[model samples]
Target chain A: MLTTAPTAVGDDAALALWVLHELHYRGFAGVDDGLEWEPTLLQVRGLLEADLERRLRGRWTPPQGLSFVDDALEWIDGQDGVSLARHVHRDADRDQVLDLLRVRSLYHLKESDPVSWLVPRLGVPAKAALMELQFDEYGNGDPNRLHHHLFATGMAAAGLEPSYDAHVDVVPLEVLEQNNTLSLFGLHRRLRGAALGHLAAFEATSSLPSRRMAEGLKRLDLPPEIIAYYAEHVEADAVHEQLAVRTIAAALLDEEPDLEADLWFGAFTCLDLEDRFARRMLDRWGVGEVAA
Target chain B: MSEPGVAFEHPDVVLCPGGPMLLRGRHTVEDADGVPHETTRPVTAVCRCERSASFPWCDGTHKVLPPKLRPA
Candidate 1:
């Protein structure tokens, strides 16, 4: 019997969606794999996804006439929000940084896998451009250099459990929502524009903040592995940002001009979610104005 | 396998306005200091702004530069 939204609404919705999404990624060891396609479970998932999309759409107001693909970087830059990277760079203490890492492991452990789902779904030009960026993200077929593996190695070196989802229990609502948004965009072919838009925003913003993260890790004298992970992103994301905005998103726009609004919506959602996450963390830490 | 009027494609390179030069395929690039760095990825963005902390390889410093100061 399909009941009202599976009784997992409100505060638990994000986590529920995350768990259900995980079934498509890597299901739990004891859980039946078939549950992933269960019509009842999917019905619940549909309700949650619809609710999430509605709420996200409500928060977003489309920007004035402009080209999203070309202006993505500038658009992202115009949004002045709290930056967790800046806080991490100069102020966060060891325990607080550790807490941040624990929450971060929820996403960093998987890295680009969510977006990988879009490979077969994109048009040729967009597909080629995305693969160009994703090739680097996956470390150009070198498993040792694979981004997620790098994060796992760093986590292990830092004395944190490196296993996938090891820190899921400690994650905040902001973290869950942030992650669920990516999976939501990735899993649905209808939201492919949003997925790439999210990718563009993420890459465009990553490089400088990655430098800050590397410096912060250095300041704390944490394990070199962890520092190296952030250092890698400083250069990697620089290249990726270009490929994402100029090539990938641009190509996608050429193929599907109608998706421009969703592209902007996705970019806005990425920045907005990050801002909320930063505010929540700073609030928890009682930190004032982040270092300039 | 030659087509009548088609030209053979070579390795790709793209120059982003006010940004880095995107290079596809592996090659050795000498930095301003004349240090040779081997390309390690399928695609690489070489610094054009000369402001990148990791010179010869862009670390996105161009984005922070003023529009007039950005790479042409």
Candidate 2:
């Protein structure tokens, strides 16, 4: 069924594999739930996952040692390519904002659950720290304060549809593949370090763009509620970056020195995927087409 | 389309056909259908939905939904 190797994003094989992975989370409405555990499906998924992992490893090299987090943070800080946030904040029209939201909804809607799968695989300080960040993501037990809800609020405010998986058919496979990488890392217990590293990179880079996004929303005269999600990230991710780097990353390294390389790979891949996404958006925007 | 880039605001909350309550600034809820219902709450507020792992907020379920469909 895989039509091609995993050399390119949005390849049919990758998309099909991503679709198969969906059965475990929210199976398509009409699909049988029992398919979640079908042995044949598992066999196919395993092969595809292996191919995906092999390709990712070839492209990304994991960092080494407890210092890897710092290096990764520094690398992210040094990045100065096309700023998607700047465009949204300074120049984007309402439609552009809507397009950005739609693309992001592909990820922000589900937020942190994929990485949470690694919690049980972690020990002591790292587990506690990850849980702490996750607790905040979950809204600290308040059903009304969760981050995903905030994202949805922004989505609705942007006038885009906000249903879960509502846009899957339209999203480019690159976006889905970016997310699939996380699911692959999170689901495999051995890859817990990479999962944490990915979270670290994500938190490190989130704050500034979040602020830019909020500014963009405000400039468009969006209501305050819709802007709240981006604003929240401006502050929350600042704190999370530290916890992810020192607590999560450092603790993870202390526990399993061997995982340092994978941790770095996770961080590097985060940067690589985001860069690709940004390029795609900018390229489309330049061509007068909505990138999502 | 209503002229691209034209900003439009709906009522404070519009109940879509689906069950997920969409908050104007807080979160959007979806029902079995893909319709998005809009709601609004305080800044950084949460949503109230059973499927939310982060509760009142989304944890990127929309993205994860696709892969979750995969077996094992």
Candidate 3:
């Protein structure tokens, strides 16, 4: 039987969902893979996902009188959110940057894996577009070019543990919530629209910020590998941003016009989660104002 | 889809207003300085703003430029 939604996705609740979701990915050592479909655990996962969905939707205000596909890029640009990128660009110290890399690894290590779940859920136009974007994300047939591996190599060069889940225990609620949101959108077939929406927002924000991050790494005199990892994003995400917003997202909306609201919700969630994450980190670092 | 049962088809050219012109497939593009840059990725954005730091490839700098200053 499903327990009532936890008052909020507090630490225990978050961890419960995290463990349950991990079953779908790389299951724990000695854990039966069949547990992925266990009724009791799935019920709990369902409840948590419902709660997360409600929380996210409650915060979103879907754009009005506008074509979401045509206007999304400009809409995202107009929003003023606290920027962790700007902080890293100008003032963050070495430890601060390293801390960010560790926290970011929670998502970066599995980069693009969440959205990959949408592949089978889409029609030809959207599916083909998504694959085109994902093909690059997965390194265009070269393991050396794979984004997560690139991050891992960069992390090792920075003297941090590049192993999977090495920093999960230390990440804050904000970080966990961010990862949870990504997984939540991806895992549900019903939320495939939101998944691509998140991808569009993510790619849109990445290119310039990657440039800033690269510059910041240079400022800290960090190793060349670390800087190169970010430098790669500058050009890569520029291409991805266009493909995501124009091709992937546009094609999806074309096929399923009713998904417009869900798309906005997902896009809003992406920016909102990052805003919250940035605020938490900036406050922790005693830096500039966090976006409200 | 580029018609049913068509094994080979997709947009080879896409133009993003106020951004860059997306060129897909294997081709070489020459910068104004007469340097040829090969299109390595499936889709490459050739800078239209003429202000890109990496000539012949967009670095997303057009976003920072004013609407009037961006490509017309």
Candidate 4:
């Protein structure tokens, strides 16, 4: 049944994986939830996930010189990709920014849900630290303050649809791959290391990019509610990055050193997928990379 | 961390190498301008790199700074 489906890391493969993963998140309108557990579908999912994993790992070569933290930071510094946020900040037209926002809403609308799956899978220090980070992602018990809700509100304020998966059809292949990678890591017990690694890398990259996004939104004359979403991230992610890396990721690795490679895999995938997404968007816009 | 039951209590303040100082719990911090910034979240990252556009709080601009310029 899966013979015709592409098994590589390109658009067709990612699209198939995305659809399969979506069943586990919020099923398609006409699709039965039972299909989420159907053997044939699960088989395809496994194959696609394996392909994606192979593709992600193919790009990573373990750093030889620096400490893990320094290596990770240097990994990001060494990445040579277009900065979509910088372009948005300095030159994107209103339509382009809005298009990017629509694509981004695919993930922002469900922020932190994937990583929350790791809370129960962890031990003490990692568990507590992850919870501390998640508590903020969950809005400190205030529904209105929830990060995803914040994104929803921002989407509405910007005159875009805020419903979950509202922009899936409009999102590019890279976005699909990005979301798939996170969901894949979060769903597997064996991949817990990768999940937190992805979390740390994600939080590390978020704060500054969020600031650029906030400025870009402000420049576009978007509503304050929209700006507030990015504004909130600028602070939240700064705290979260430290919590994820120094506290959560470190604690996990200290207990299970065997998972170091997978941890690095997840982090590299996080940066790599984002770079692909940024490059795709910039190429589509025919915009050159802005100075970092 | 492998010691199972050993307590790993959250420190009130964590000095992240080359990054921010994470202050846990509540406190009011005075920035260079002498204005007080209240702790709104359960944990806050105070800008040690001093390049945060948010002033007292980190906005993550430290990542853009040269490694030598980042806080030790």
Candidate 5:
């Protein structure tokens, strides 16, 4: 099944890669659990990861004279990616919003699990800082407060399928690539810098946009659970961003220093992938073209 | 304040430069409206800029403000 599925390029390759990465996460039913490390499958995963990484690296140039760990929030704020949240805030109809929820459910259901891989691989201060942020992400030891579970609750309340990977088939190529990037950075010890960079970028960008999302849901009269999910992030991520950029990512940089470029690369990739996804969604919805 | 090499086990409260005050435990924060809000998480950021739409809790509006308008 791994070698034969028209896995050369585009959505086909993306889906194939996503399924391969899923082996490491929650494997599909009836699949051999040990296949997560099978040599041939590992080779295929490596080739696909290399391809994706090269493509991402080729598109990013580190921001001149800017320090990713120190200036992260401002650097990210300067980025002009198209906003799906803004569109949802003012323009999306009910059907379009529902479709977006389904697409977002791909990542929202899994939430912070990708970065959890870095826990065992980090040094003391960075590890402690990451857990400080991640503990909140995981609902501070309360399962009901867990972010992903919160998303699942909202999904079910919105009358959408709430199970993990339930919307994978409906997701566009950009969405798959976005998921794959997180997995790629998270699972590689060599890319721990990138992983935290990605985490910092993700948290820094979340707070305001989350408020927009909550407002949008309110305007649409969507389920209260769904609105609450976004509302939760508005405050949660404000705290998390400070922890991620200043405490977590900065601590890692203090120890290594050489990973700075890759850290910026990772941060840039996060913004770049989200931009691609947002543009694709907005264009599909006929919202308007996002400037390049 | 302790000497140069000092580090506390865990600083329960931190003032983030140009940002919010991070409180690491639960506390009742009374907003300008005099309504009290109890924190439910391990850490909470109390808005310092007085510009947050969320009021007592930061919604990160401080970051969007001019540097002069931001909290110290």
Candidate 6:
């Protein structure tokens, strides 16, 4: 049955859904591996996914054409709100940086694997562009330099565990949901447009925060290697931002004209969720509480 | 109960309280009854499979287990 609404954040419903989704990626240590394809679990997952999609579509208007990329780029460029990276760069302490790392690790540890699911479903230019971005994310075939590995290294430098799924329990639902959204889009072949849009939005907004994150690490007196991960994003995403928008999103529209709306919906939902996450962090930080 | 925060390279099969079988690979946790539970939850115990030093958890050692006996 389809869900009427999105699962509430941090509730058992969301966590249970997240666990079910996790089965598709990396099954938990002691859980039955066979449950990954259990019909009952898929039924529940479909409901949760539908709910999430309904909420996102309801809240965000998808753009009508390839031109939506231009509008999205403009909107992203015009956003002049308080910056999370700025806080990290200018005033964060060790604990604050660590907290940030912990929250981000929820996504970065797994890196681009979620989005990679869409690769087989995409056509030419878009697929190639995605591979271009993903190659760097995966460290261009160097196991030691993969973004996930770098993220893990950063986590380790901050005294957090580097193992995959190590911090699942501590990450806030918002963080989990952000990653879940991407996974949701990526896993569904029909949502290829949305997946690309999500990546575009992600890349568009990443550079500055990455720089700020690097600055935050430096301000906290962390080692250079710990800061390198963020610093690397500053450069990599700047390039990727262009590829994601023009090549991936635009090219996908060129191939499948009807998908423009889904693309925009994906991009906007990404931005919306990010804004919520950022605002939550800023509000917490404003009140002198740890945002993570 | 197992000590918290210890990393096991491999684990041994351990009987649960009710005689259920548990495979220890990469992460550790008690086998609840006889059913193996896969979770992202931190491993608090080791698996019992001799292949993994992590004990009470599958460190993915089962990946290379002889082609015939591999856990699907």
Q: A143-214, model 2: which lDDT tens digit per residue?
A: 677888888876776677888777776666568778788889887898887788788888877776777788
Query: Across residues A143-188, which tens digit of lDDT does each residue of candidate 3 receive?
Result: 9989998999999999999987789888888888888889999999
Can you write out model 5's per-residue Cα lDDT over A19-51, one digit (the tens) per residue? 999999999999999999998888888888888
**Selected candidate, larger lDDT, 2 vs 5:** 5
Looking at model 5, the pairs that clash are none
State the fraction of real interface contacts model 6 keeps: 0.00
TM-score of each: 0.95, 0.74, 0.95, 0.93, 0.94, 0.74
Estimate candidate 5's alpha-carbon lDDT, on a 0 to 1 scale.
0.88
By the DockQ metric, which is better: model 4 or model 6? 4
Give the per-residue lDDT digits (tens) of candidate 2, residues B1-72: 123565533334432111122333446666456766453322222222334443444322222234344212
Off by over 4 Å in 3: A6-9, A290-292, B1-9
Q: Model 5: C-alpha RMSD to truth? A: 3.2
Off by over 4 Å in 5: A1-7, A290-292, B1-9
Q: Model 3: which docking level applies?
A: medium
State candidate 6's DockQ.
Answer: 0.01
CAPRI-wise, candidate 1 is acceptable
Q: Residue B60 error for model 5, in Å?
A: 1.1
Once fitted onto the true fold, the runs of candidate 4 whose alpha carbons sit more than 4 angstroms away are: A1-9, B1-5
Q: State, as a TM-score between 0 and 1, how close model 3 is to the true structure.
A: 0.95
How displaced is residue A21 in candidate 3, in Å? 1.3
Q: Report the Cα lDDT for residue A57, model 4.
A: 85
- What TM value does model 5 have? 0.94
Model 6: residue A22 alpha-carbon error in angstroms = 1.0
